[model samples]
Target chain A: MLIPHPLLGPRDAQEFTYLGDAALLARPDGMAEGALGAFIDYVYLRDNPAGVHRELWFHEQGDRSWLVVTRNTVTHEIIDAQLARDVALARKGAVA
Target chain B: MRFSGFRVIKEALTGHKGWQPLWRNPDPKPAYDYVIVGGGGHGLATAYYLANTFRKARIAVLEKGWLGSGNIGRNTTIIRSNYGLPGNQPFYEFSMKLWEGLEQEFNFNAMVSQRGILNLIHTDAQRDAYRRRGNAMLFSGADAELLDRDRVRDMCPWLNFDNARFPIKGGLMQRRAGTARHDGVAWGYARGADRAGVDLIQNCEVTGFRIEEGRIRGVETSRGYIAAAKVGVAVAGSTSRVMEKAGLRLPIESHVLQAFVSEGLKPLIPGVITFGAGHFYVSQSDKGGLVFGGDIDGYNSYAQRGNMPVIEDVIEGGMALMPMIGRARLLRVWGGIMDMSMDGSPIIDRTPVEGLYLNAGWCYGGFKATPASGYSFAHLLATDTPHETARHFRLDRFARGHVIDEKGMGAQPNLH
Candidate 1:
């Protein structure tokens, strides 16, 4: 699969890889609860990729946020991931 | 021929027997036909005009210094007539004409260079304002043209036309506007007046005025007493001090303006360029160096030195206009005190002290107006009537409220 470069062309970044299910797409919305609606819109847009098998994953414990997955065309396997904790927990460690 | 021969023999005898000093005082018959104080450009020019035009040759020009050594030598020489006021337009126009024919009149090469002047407009409002000014110049029979961005680019390709801060939209170009050697202007008039048998007294500082009953009688100089029937003061920066001695207060401020020059470079800036939005103007000297100056040092000080803020502001404006000049190192910077009047225009009129006259208050534009100022001042001194153009610059205008505030900054030292 090929992705068009933002400024240049589709063939500009040839080193790009498409990871299946392992790649988590993260689009940041504002931190307010009202911005969760915008996060839903982001998830909906990513889940509806035009004719591709888009995988979805949920991290309930670690970062306690939603994560989306996609397939890699060059390596035909899972490659990368991301948690939607907007706030990183390791930096803000759980001091119970 | 007999008269000329007799004059020559008398002069020869005077020179031989050291009787020259005795008869040296041309106005030895006591009361002079006319007397002019503050032997600057205007005073000398006034005397020259009195002799040449009115045929009033019994004139004396008293100078504190040796002549051509006052503010006349310390100005950033710029000559232009792009004025916006009705009163100042014709006056500066006359001055421009005089500047055009100065070398011939004085037989002294003032190095008057008609290199043209461009007032770079930055905004639409400024463009409109300069458009009106240019039209005014044209209406008043002067040469002024509005140059668009393309023309500006063609004329000065190095300008930062695309800068975000103050983009250069266009400019007002006056083809006749240029510069003259400042010191040469003073010296030329001095030599001419000296040759015309007018006494150019140097080292004679006017310490006090001998006013008898409410009229000026004579002046008390550092040397001795000199009886002056009619006196004119042409001291620009020190006008207030002289006026005070006459028991009069003026609405003039003594502000110091500084000018800087860059190390010599191959002729890059062919003509004068003044940034309208910014307080900076630049012109190249024949010596391949860039001469530039800006607004005055914002306080009242007689000391001929300026601070760093004005220097930095000027350089910053220059860099914004032409960033390439950032590489050019500054060579020297100097300051000259200006007698800024309530209005930006000069004061050239007879004082209330009967025989006393004035030709001071030339803010920053004195150098360009040297020849015309001198010529008109001479006319006034000889005829005792204000010249047609200089009638607006009366000394009592501030009190009477007929002020010709060209810049609309009344009597404010910082504003003018």
Candidate 2:
């Protein structure tokens, strides 16, 4: 499998280190109200879908930047890849 | 018909006309007292124990496809109970005990061979870790032996002992650990469950659950709706998808694990051997093919196929461990979907949804835990309480902060 990095061209998947779902970027507030429940859900529960998925991958062998790669879990087709920093900023902007 | 030495002689003499089917393909009934999802090894074994040990009636096992067409038949078929944690050691040891009498009681030929298993030690720190692990195994009433370098050489002199990168300093041996016929295990449990009057329904995909005011009434399947008083789900790989029908998420991510088999050759590997410095384990099948595997593909995927990097990594480990294995041409390789949990252990408990129970999060170790998983699941279904051997496998453990983090990898599912 090849992952198309936003910065570099398409590279072999072996060059990247995988951390699971992109939902992991949304770490819950530790000091907020009902923090324990939110932290438990954030740390444990996962929406592990069988179809389309957006996940985090670290370009450990190259630029060391994390990318949010939109891919299909069933077909293994990479739809798009973007910098994780931009995605996180977009999510935070939407929330605000 | 009962199989014996005399029966074999009679079949040899009489043209073999008395052969019978192993199980019955029964249609789903309108209702059953107990309904189990997933007709793989653990599901069938659970049904068998429910009827035999617990004496439960009107039990049914629903299969999405043909029986044993999942991870049950896809594993490399190594069975051992050399666990180091308190929560997991006794449970697996109980499962290992069940494996001892599995074939005889089930009245099938499962080929339960207990030759031995050796985990090679590459460094002094690894040797210390194995020593503690061996002591843990002995404390759990399981067998474990710490062998020195010469002792390991005496057992398997063909190993790369002298001029290697990470020389084998020692090994941890479990004399009663070995392989069994994976397909035979599934068929044996199916036959036993069939004989006990449990319906084994195949090609019946469960689409949704019929939840009535927080209680499970039954499941809506591809065939039709079937009512049941209690429902237990044992689908590990597809747990997240299946449980979503009931409006629940899990602490799991699915990954692909690959296993390979070399062409049949003369017997070389005595039993199972695991490389301490890398992620490779190997065993020789009865057909003389060397069965081997390495770590998962390290990604979230439901596809039952792996990429080339892991395959190359596993072959490299094998070559580093024993250079002679490089000459064996690879015959076939395949992958299985693994339901990796956050804590790297399994969960067997009642769900928040009343009348619903769950047996999942087994990761890649589900094959070896088939018997005890079934027995404990059966006991829970019958008595509505966790079995003594599996009380730590609670679904609420994560929220309660009582997670069984055996590998100490924290909440990273893929890392575990």
For candidate 1, give the docking quality class from DockQ: incorrect
Docking quality category of candidate 2 according to DockQ thresholds: high
Model 1 chain A worst lDDT window (10 residues): A43-52
Each prediction's total of clashing residue pairs, residues at least 3 apart in sequence or on different chains, is 9, 0
Pairs of residues at least 3 apart in sequence or in different chains that clash in candidate 1: A18-A72, A19-A71, A19-A72, A20-A70, A20-A71, A20-A72, A21-A70, B46-B378, B342-B411
Tens digit of per-residue lDDT, candidate 2, span B1-416: 77788999998899998888988999999999999999998899999999999999999999999999889989999899988999999999999999999988998899999978999998899899999999999999999999999999998888888645788999999988899999999999999999999999999999999998999999999989999999999998999999999999999899999999999989888999998477889999999999999999999889999889999999998888888988899999999999999999999999989999999999989988999999999999999999998999998999999999888999999888
User: What C-alpha lDDT, on a 0 to 100 scale, does residue B95 get in candidate 1?
Assistant: 94
- Writing each residue's lDDT as its tens digit, candidate 2 over A1-96 gives 898887798988898999888998999999999999999999999999999999999999999999999999998899999999999999999999
What interface Cα RMSD is found for model 1? 36.0
Task: Say which candidate scores most in lDDT.
Answer: 2
Query: TM-scores across all candidates?
Result: 0.75, 0.99
> Candidate 1's residue-wise lDDT over B42-153, tens digit each?
7777777777666777778877876767788887789999998877888899999988988888767788999999999889988998999888898888999999999999
TM-score of 2: 0.99
